[model samples]
Target: MAAKTNPGRFFEDYATGQVIHHAVPRTVKMGERALYHMLYPARHALYSSDQFAQACGLPFSPLDDMVAFHVVFGKTVPDVSLNAVANLGYAEGRWITPVWPGDTLRSVSEVIGTKQNSNGKTGVVWVRTRGLNQHDEVVLEYVRWVMVRKRDAGAEVAATVVPELAQVVPTKDLVIPKGLDFTNYDFTLAGEPHRWGDYEIGETIDHVDGVTVEEAEHMLATRLWQNTSKVHFDTSARPDGSRLIYGGHVISLARALSFNGLANAQMVVGLNAGAHANPCLAGDTVRAWSEVLDKAETAAPGVGAIRLRLVATKGGAPFALRDESGKYLPEVLLDLDYWALMPI
Candidate 1:
């Protein structure tokens, strides 16, 4: 008799240019939005109120951008990172289309590059993943690399292939949702007086809020997205016996905290890069801050794009990201570069 359960794909299983269609298409409903807000302190007006969104030219409130990202990303975990040591980094991420409630989403990944690690016990795999709605329109896409364990340490694999990725998603390439007009955007209702022009390049904002991670919440968040990563769920997966908090958990927490000072930066449109600097565990109080990287004007009426560096730290002085040597500090949990839509 043969084993029926899947052992998951190992390092040697991937090949450059290989296409993998992930399983389980999820139908996102208003319940997901409610649960997401329940899990994190999400307060972006456009996602929180239908009237607010309609006033900005959208039909109604769409799901939060991170909600679409996590659902899509979770669908790929079983195939891409079930045996992964760590999710290395992300680049060239973009939210191509808005995900409304009741939209069914699915994911597909293409292996763009692979490199065998020096230790032979593990290797790195780079893949480009896309999330599509039931209409078959792509809603989100990104490039991410993960270090995965080898099934057989002695097996020889192909030569290393690394794909060249964009350091920044060019502003011109950003897709503003059709009919999104911020001309009538209300600053009072949005909960901030700042507009796009109010922010200057190189400005840093300390969002003074913190959330102590709970084991039950983190586990629930991971399961909500259907992510089956062992490290996030099973303590035995890590030698330290601590269940690792999903990096996306930190990303959402930090984004939610940013609302204190960035309440007007509405929609997340682009993800240039991200790094999970250190593992976050239960009992760690997470804090966040953001730095204005750049600003650009869009063709949309009263619309603008702002590039920001959002950083999450467990416990550290605000604005302190790296050491003199350029390595991430021990307290840093996540460093994310992204672009958002704001009224000009």
Candidate 2:
């Protein structure tokens, strides 16, 4: 039987200096690339057209950076936060490198701080997680806080303190993938010429397209990210012997699918938050829906900021996702909020 774990824990369980090395290693492939395009309708010539990527001096367009982050973070969920009461926030997040198809990924986390809550039922644990590529180079890093349950409600309380963190990463800390030079970026195939000035706030878009994932596809994807969690790959390891799809795969596929309607969104600027509403399994056909949350002018001449809500569902008409509780359906795999850069 698969091991059972309680992700939620009291502050007393953590120490000022602790390290949690997550399990699983994932690998990326062309199937993921094809799915990304079908899902997002991303028209970034580099990601969509091989010729365009070559012109920009890359062997090929690599998988999006967010894809890597999602893969790495998903592996930690069962081990670190399955029982979490709340996710406080993130800090010091950075992408240090690019991830191409065929690359492997893994992750490790360290406890940076801890605090006891006055309520006594829960406490906060601060951890810094680092994602590493197959080459052992750091690809991404972020600090996050979670409210964990106390093993003993009556346990004596210790120190009550919280560590401070930056609200947003500085511009210099944003790592543009190596060899990325927009100098030769194509406006025609890239889908829009409206640099930074053309968007209005509160615009809603419907990205149209659907994809059905197979057990093989998700297993390969999770393995590429170096995420070896058995639930995602080992059917025999579970009571049902059914493999669970990686949440990041669904997120990446949904974001990529968002490209159909949001083709002008060229880069992700901010990530507000995200959730995987239900378990995804092989043989599920996935479709996407999106709504503009807000908009803002950016410093980039041709780029404007568009906040969006992206959702993914299984086997239904567009937007046909909700659960028995009348909430977002259980087949709905994701609900995400983020900011993207679009040409005005």
Candidate 3:
């Protein structure tokens, strides 16, 4: 008897506006939260201590923002990027609500746009994915585009319509978690006294910390997210013969390193845009820096939104992003723009 298994969807199989409901709803717990901290130097006080969260008006500490993002993003891999060449970029990402330890999450993706590449071997597929809790509440949603291989290179082409995504999430659309009140935010326990007002637009802060990536850590982190991208696991997948570190791993590391200077900038509520400017491999020493982009007052008491440009580099010159020719410098790994909640 022949057994059936999923070979995953190829570029030719996807059409604009197609919706895919992913499988396997995952239930999170304290163990997941604990392991997240161990995997990265994540020490955001609001997500680490129940008492500290209570002080800010949350009933209890919620899972780290990256945890929720990884869990949700993982569920879509098998269905979306199982045979992808590379994840190109992200835009219009927002966390609508806090994901608690007990919450169960699942993902659904809608193919918003697709364009066949000139090479004919692959095409770009853009999807808007939503992560929803058990109660059907949307926890997060974002738009991502990936390069996917075609089942048949000679297949007839269709009209390519690339969806126009916002360059940045509007400040008015940012969601403040229920019961969040930073008015009483404790600077002493929060680890830094710098509030939202302390940061000047365009000010840059270099996080004075670096971590060398290891093969084991990269593999574990990729598996933890259930990310099935072959390039991240199979070294033979790339000509360099080096396993590429998951971009999310680098993002988390950069965010954690920024803690020394941005400890008070808690709660990542918006992701305006992100790009894995260059491939990150094991043995690379990753360093990070942040530039204040903009600021906005949130509807929640004591909670304000501060926009930042977080750049991760492989020992690049501090604040060095684009090269003289307008391309990202080879030493730069990630360039992310997002909004975080901080005490006003």
What TM-score would each prediction reach against the true structure?
A: 0.99, 0.65, 0.98
Residue 344 accuracy (lDDT) in model 3: 95
Summarize candidate 3's per-residue lDDT along 52-74 as a digit string, tens digits. 99998989999999999999999
* lDDT pick, better of 1 and 3: 1
**Model 1, runs deviating above 4 Å:** none
Residue 326 deviation, candidate 2, in Å? Answer: 9.8
Q: For this target, which candidate reaches the highest TM-score against the unseen true structure?
A: 1
State the local distance difference test value for candidate 3.
0.92
Q: Rank the candidates by TM-score, best first.
A: 1, 3, 2
Best by lDDT: 1
Against the unseen true structure, what C-alpha lDDT does each candidate score? Answer: 0.97, 0.67, 0.92
Clashing residue pairs in candidate 3 are: none
Off by over 4 Å in 2: 1-16, 20-43, 48-63, 70-108, 112-126, 132-138, 143-185, 192-198, 236-241, 315-327
lDDT of 1 at 54: 98
lDDT of 2: 0.67
Deviation of model 3 at 304, angstroms: 1.0
Better of 1 and 2 by lDDT: 1
